[model samples]
Target: MDDKKPLKRHEALKPLSRQHHFGLLFSWKLRKGFAGNISVNRLKAYADWFFVHEIEPHFKLEEDHIFPILGVRDALIVRALKEHRRIERLFHDQDNPKNSLSLLEEELEAHIRFEERVLFAEIQKVATQQELKKIEEIHFEIGSKEEYMDTFWEKN
Candidate 1:
C-alpha cells in the first residue's frame, strides 16, 4: 500500500522531470544489457554517450538553477549533489567497468526515484513563482530523438 502524499509538479520543472524519465530508461537499458550478457565495454560506451548527450546538461541545469532554490546547505540538495557526483564517477570508472556498470544501473535508478519522489517535491513546495518562471525560461533544449546505433539491449 502506498501512503506517500501525491505531488503535483509545477509546470516549470516538467522538462527536468521528462529528462528524469529518460534517465530511468537509461538505467533500464543498462539492466537489460547486463541481463542479456552484453559486453561491459559496449555498455560503457553507451554510458559515455549518454553522459555527454543527456546527464551532463541535466546536471548543469539542476546545479545552476534548481538547487539554488533550496540553497546548497539543504539536506535534500546535499544528497542530490552527492548522488550526482557518485553517478558521474560510476559512469567514468575504467578500472572495473563491469562492476561499475552494475552499480551504475542500480544507483542511477535510485537517484531518479529520489529526485522524483522527494527532492522535486520539496522544491516545488518551497519555490516561489518567480523562481519557477526563471527555471522555465532557461530553455533546457535537450537532444533530439535520434537513436543510438547500438541495439544491444533489444532482443533480435
Candidate 2:
C-alpha cells in the first residue's frame, strides 16, 4: 500500500467524498444487520432504500462527472463501472437477500476502497482545475429523509 496520503479532493469532488461516507456506513449497517441476525427482509428493505436514494445517484455522478476526468477508456474506469453494475444487482436481488446482502457488504467496501485508494488518486492527478470546478458546480448534496424505521442493528 502507498504510504502517501491520498490527494486532497477538490471542493467540487467533496460531495462525492460525502457519498463515500454513506457508502462506508452502508457496509457497516449490513455487517451489523447480519451479526445481529436481523431479518433478511429488514436488511433488504434498507438496502433497497439506500440503493435508490444514495447509491444510484452517487454512481451516476461518478460515471457522468468524475470518471471523465480519466477518460472512459481507462482500465480503472472499466472496472469501476463493472463493479457498479454488480453491486447494483446485488442490492436488487430479492430472491436471495441473505446472500445478496452479504456480498453487498463486501463488494461495496471493496469498491469504495478502490476508488479512494486508486481511481480517485489517479483522477485527481490528471484532472484539470476547470474540470474539477465543473464537477463542483453540478454536485448536489444528499440529505436524509425519513429515518430507518427498524432499529435492530442498534440493539446489539
Candidate 3:
C-alpha cells in the first residue's frame, strides 16, 4: 500500500494538472492501440497530433511559467527538462514507430507521475503568492480541447 498522503495542488497549477490528466489519457490510448494491434503509422499519426496539440504547448508553459518557481539549478527542474527532451525525441523519432511509440507510452506516463507527485509538490511549497498569481494567469492560455475523430482506441 502507498504510504504517502495526497498532495493538494494549488489553484495556480490546476490547469497544468488538468493537462496532465489528458496526458495520462493519451498514454492510455497508446496502450489500447498497441493491444488492439493498431497500425504503427496510425498510432504515430495520433501521437503527432497530440504532440502538437497538447504536449508541445504544455511543455512550453511549464518551462516558461511553472518550473521557474524552483529555478534552473534545482534538481527537479533538471530532471524534468531531461524528461521533456526525452519525450520530445520519442515523439519526433519516426524510423522505428513501434519501438518509439512504446517507449513514448511508458516514459510519458512516468514523467507525468513524477511531475504530479514530486516536482509540482516542490514548486507549490516554494512559490510565493505573487509567483503563483503569475502562474495562475497561465490558465487563459490553456487551449480548448479540439476533437480528434479517429477513435482507433475505442472498441469496434
- Most TM-score-accurate candidate: 3
The reply for model 2, stretches above 4 Å from the true place, is 1-7, 143-145
Q: Write the per-residue lDDT of candidate 3 for residues 58-86, one digit (tens) a residue.
A: 99999998888899889999999999999
Displacement of the residue 141 alpha carbon in candidate 1, Å: 2.8
Worst 10 residues of 2 by lDDT: 139-148
In candidate 1, what are the lDDT values of residues 1-156, reduced to their tens digit?
999776678889988999999999999999999889888888999999999999988999899999999999999999999999999999899999999989998999999999998999899999999999999998886865678899888952
Q: Give stretches of model 3 more than 4 Å off.
A: 1-4
State the C-alpha lDDT per candidate.
0.91, 0.86, 0.91
Give the TM-score (vs. native) of candidate 2: 0.92
Q: State model 2's lDDT.
A: 0.86
Indicate the residue-level lDDT of 62 in model 3.
93
Tens-place lDDT digits, model 2, residues 35-85: 988889889888988988889988987888889888888999999999999
All candidates' TM-scores?
0.94, 0.92, 0.94
The lDDT of model 1 is: 0.91
Evaluate residue 120 in candidate 2 and report its C-alpha lDDT on the 0 to 100 scale: 86
Cα lDDT for residue 156, model 1? 28
Better of 1 and 2 by TM-score: 1
List RMSD in Å for every model shown.
1.6, 2.1, 1.5
Off by over 4 Å in 1: 1-6
